[model samples]
Target chain A: MGQDGSVPAYENASKESPQPRPRLRRSVEDGWIAGVCAGLAHHLGFDVRVVRATFVLGTILLNGLGLLAYLVIWALTPQALDGEHADAPRPAPTSLPRLDRAIRALRTSGRDEAFGNVLGGLALVVLGAALLLERHGVNLRLGLVLPLGVIVVGAVIGWSQLDRAERSSWLNESSFSGRRGVLRVGVGLVLTIIGVLLLATQERGWAGMGDAALSALAVLTGAVVILTPWGLRLWEKVKREQAQAIRATERADIAAHLHDSVLQTLALIQRKADDPAQVQRLARAQERELRAWLYGGGQSAETTLAAAAKAAADDLEDRYGVPVEVVVTGDHPLDPDTQALVRALTEAMSNAVRHARPPVSAYVECGASGIEAFVRDHGDGFDLDAVPADRLGVRGSIVERIERHGGTARIRRLSDGTEVALTLPVHRPVNQSLNQPVNQQTLPLKEAHDA
Target chain B: MPEPRATTHGPIRLVLVDDHRMFRAGVRTELDDSLPVVGEAGDVDTAVEVIRRERPDVVLLDVHLPGGNGRGGTDVILGCAGTTTESGAPVRFLALSVSDAAEDVISVIRAGARGYVTKTIVGEDLVTAIHRVADGDAVFSPRLAGFVLDAFGAAAGEIAEVDSELDRLSAREREVMRLIARGYQYKEVAKELFISVKTVETHVSSVLRKLQLSSRHELTAWAMNRHLL
Candidate 1:
């Protein structure tokens, strides 16, 4: 029996300890007639032949009740191959009897009207039986049975109509005012009137009318219940459409916003295409600005100072066709001030590519307190003090742009290369805001340098 | 660059669309002896109007222009083609641009331009590109062909898989990829790496196949996206 390779290792371990009582699971490999007796023997730690003999004796002694019990056990216990092992007790089985499944289906079907119709039909059958019994002088009450039958029919019709109206209420209210809603109202009124008339024609005249009026009340109550849900659903649908319309208008506003700002900037760029250098500078600066704005100005999780520095270096290399090696040390999200700092670094890189020779590199070091960038080039070094005033490439683009943002720019001349270092505090200065005109500040600096 | 071929048919009619008037004039003076200029427009709207009215055999299109609703060259192509070609025989567009940026190249090519060339191209090469595009053969500036291949050949989702393939490249192959992606000419890459141009070509093709990339342009974009450059 143990030679079966299909039995998992855990099953063997389970067989060694029988005190805790392993769960009952059908044996797939070793079993006759659905493995019920073998499974029971394995779980209970008894000889398989003894369990089988007991089942047979019990079946004969108990008038085949034991056979019925065996069938029930076979249906209830899941196969061990289905991952239900004797050592591991599973949660309550999901496999239900056929009768339980039918009850569950009826409860969860969501067809309330259909259920009501079925109950009404059964009531009608009972009413008809009672009427036949009365004709044979079986003493059945015709008045009670007839009124009950009329109420049940009215209620069923009201229920079905209400369910349909509620479902259709998602359509516009104007559409609901068409023939369908009116037809339902007319049918409900007619049924309610018929119920009242039936009561009036009962024996004892006006007093019988009172008793039959109860059936009319039931019909009216059912109709009200149907209409109430329809009204609520219609209200919800109207609210949803209003919200949708508001969102659509908001989207249109955003589209117009993009057209006014981003599209206009693009048009300006295209107009300046004749001056390739100006276009390149504008395109690079505008791309960074737009990315900062569109991505919410450093609020995005991915926008780090190191990433911005690397991108600026890459752009400069591609634009000028110069080789730039960028080394970034620390990473952190950038504020608008630091974004300006990065743009200034880009201008410095471009100057290095333009004025300096090949083998240019940028080093960026960011910390919690401040950030610094050094753009170094391996060209003939130039004296910073001797730069011409009209050469706004270094003065206007790098120095003033950084200084205006409460940062510092320093130029150092090496024996064979020049390095421009920029530093900025983590927080903006009290006097500096994002809207400050950096260009206006740079214009005066250009005049001072030129003078 | 290829040599200009003698045409068996009549002079290839052409329209020039560029925002820069000087550039248009330069191209006109260079190619006037070979291909006759039939029409011209500075922006997308007038470009479409002139190309449709003239029914030119070829149109030298610029990638970026004002007006035409901010879409630039793609708008001109669409305005002329609508859903399909209006002239029965489709009007071919040869994109001319100063920008060698991959996005600019890929966007115009995706909009169905017959070919693309940078403004640095000499007059003879420009004429050759025009002739090839008129003959319904695709032409591209050497490295620009890689952009078209990358945009159309590989699915966008497969680009993420390129990261794993980067590990598969040998050390020498990695050096060639970085240089090529950095916008180096094949000869320049060969010179920089001290290898023959043929050896560089072999390494490039091997690297492209291993990375499942279609062209050098895609390799550049892939490297740039991974920050490997």
Candidate 2:
């Protein structure tokens, strides 16, 4: 993480900063029952083979529980995740603003979400209506309404929950089979009850012959209607290509470290602390641990610096009661302590808040090495000589701060009010040394796919 | 280097808070006779609980602590950052830290400290700083003073002239000039100034011209250089 955590490492260390995070969507060509696995693998930067292998291993280990789970994913997952649709490549790293504009420009993405929610609401309504009709002695199987109603409800909620899983990255996990089972049983039982009600209506209304034809038509139409949105996904295609490219650029040693160690240790650390000191110690530990992990005996590419700027923001909020707004724009480790510097920044903020007779705007910037905090009160300025040597509101707080850190802090009267600034040394991270480009030992992604 | 003694401003009931037991003991030893000890705490959590109970007028704080003891747990600095006196009551903070880390100094102060004096402060200075902070006057050690001056200089451009101005005037000259600047004429300046007109004139002439100005208007302008007007 960046030395203090005020900065996001991904924006600094990664060669691919300009790229925004991927959205989950359908993929067309690599359709393993509508590309749910591919889309998930692509979104989270995992190998589809590994994801597929994980599912395979689990199926074997669990006596084919995994395969049964896969079939359910095939049934319940919204078909739009298939990659055959969207034609976009992974946009270049520098194209972020344009990408956001592109996303905003695309009316279809919002339209799709709106369509899903509307369908979900409609599905519930129709299912309720058909059951009511069935109770009223109207035949829907020989009739057209009841069975069609069940499919409609199933499609709507099914798409909705699938979207949730997409947003959460659940499908990328090796335990997805287990997770999908939970997803299905909960949703499946409800949908199954609706199915039985629809069937009950069938027995009361139409003959078996007409009911049979209508059921086939309903299934066909249901599949077609669900699959139509498959034409609009953007995340799927871009994710697949970039993922293919990353796998091609992958160093085996780096991949192994990421898979076998880092995440597990971080999960342990996240669980261990609740207070600032614990978090600070853990953050420092993360820095050292991540460094050791990076240079460990294995050959490595640049360490992944996906560490967030907001984690630092959260830490600052927790300890200092200071609100920090972070705008991440580079690649490097953004650790937890960097955010806490806002407390230092609020030296300006607090002076303005507590003592400014006529309140003025104060602006502050915090970074790894030091902080610059300044406040201007709109009220008035005073004589330095007449003013007592023991200026408490400021010198007690603002100026002494720099000395405490072996840095610098000061306050001065402008034409209007006082301004203060402080700078402190930050622990420099090894990731900074990686600013020099090194050749990535390319991965076998395209080779694996082409083969 | 002078030994500390109890002052006439009543007991500045102080709490010694730091994770380092020896350092806390040393401060307690140094200030025990000069300032009454309400309690002692060594971690953020316990320090917090102690300060809440004792309500000491002054908290002597250290920046770093062990056992998750630093920052907010029982630390008075962290606890007091958001706290203020209820209408009228006195609770102040004097930070005692070895760290000259700028960020830490700034943080403790922002976290509600009233003064910052280093651990290296002599027995007398530390006691004096504690009393001053308790009495609602903030204090900083000389080293921190320089840093603050540097920060101020950097922040609002420069104030070498103020120090230069002080250097240019003698003590008596400053006194005479103060009266003149307060609107006293040569005779009135001489009366309040406790000097003869020739002396006031000499002081005023030196104050005006040496401050590099030609007239009383320019003298006032030079005196008011920072725009306090």
- For model 2, the superposed segments whose C-alpha errors exceed 4 Å read A1-451, B1-12, B19-36, B42-49, B63-89, B98-112, B119-125, B131-137, B154-229
**Residue-by-residue lDDT tens digits, candidate 1, B30-138:** 9955688989899988998898788887889999899887979988988888322233456778888755445566667656776677676667667877876665555
Top-scoring candidate (TM-score): 1
Docking class of 1: incorrect
What are the lDDT figures for the candidates, one per model? 0.59, 0.46
Q: lDDT, candidate 2, residue B3? A: 13
> Tens digit of lDDT per residue, candidate 2, span A1-451?
0122212222242233233434444342453444545555554567666767876885787555455444334333444433433543432233234543343345335434434433433444454445544544754333344334344434543454434233223223323534663554345444444444444555543455455345444443444344333322223434445666777677675677665556665676688656655654555445434544543333232231212223333343445433332221112332322322333445545554344443333333333344443344434655544544434434444444334444555555544455444454456442333222222232111100000
lDDT of 2: 0.46
TM-score attained by model 1: 0.36
